[model samples]
Target: MVEDPLALWKALRNRYNHQRTVILPRARYEWTHLRIQDFKSVAEYNSALFRITSQMKLYGDTITEEDILEKTFSTFHASNVLLQQQYRAQGFTEYNQLISVILVAEQNNELLMKNHQS
Candidate 1:
């Protein structure tokens, strides 16, 4: 029972450090294989990106917003080259910024599709 928060955090970190041996290789593999087009939806891809990156970070890998942004833009569908370029031009500083735009665009596209079907 550590009364100090910092000490408690350190204790927890030490206790779980051994899991790093098992987790790092798997996390790295997932990170390498992750691609946007593999997912059926933006949300699904976003969730996976975070999950893998969080694991990597837990094991001391440094993941930046630029890394995530480039990974996403590079994996955009071939037909979406212009769209990818447009997003890059926007210069989003964070993953959430880009994801929010994507989610909104997807939602708006769905609404347009529903209207077209009616």
Candidate 2:
């Protein structure tokens, strides 16, 4: 008699409401504590950001591009204050734009270091 699984799905969703109690706070904690400098690479930071934000979204949180960009800017390493200011001055409205630029910069820095080692 369960030809339509819609009712079953709804029941599952409602029954699992307690999951939000567990997941939402954990997601928020991870999000707040996330710092780009903690990761070894831009890609790793990006991956973790998406994962945390997606979890927050699942729990009815709105994670906007501006929020993401601001979070990234604010969490940069303290030693890179000038670099952070420069990136912030770029006025990146989208997270992807800023991240792409940072990724390219990281690659260029690595290349420069390799050249220096030669």
Best of the candidates, lDDT: 2
Could you tell me which residue pairs clash in candidate 2?
none
Candidate 1 TM-score to native:
0.82
Stretches of candidate 1 exceeding 4 Å from the true structure: 1-18
Worst 10 residues of 1 by lDDT: 31-40
Give the number of colliding residue pairs in candidate 2. 0
User: For candidate 1, lDDT tens digit of each residue in 1-118?
Assistant: 8999999999999998789999989999998888898998899999999999999998899999999998998998898899999999999989899999999998899999999999
Evaluate residue 7 in candidate 2 and report its C-alpha lDDT on the 0 to 100 scale. 86
Candidate 1: clashing pairs of residues: none
Q: What lDDT tens digits, residue by residue, belong to model 2 across residues 33-110?
A: 999999999999999999999999998999999999999999999999999999999999999999999999999999
For candidate 2, report its TM-score: 0.88
The TM-score leader among the candidates is 2
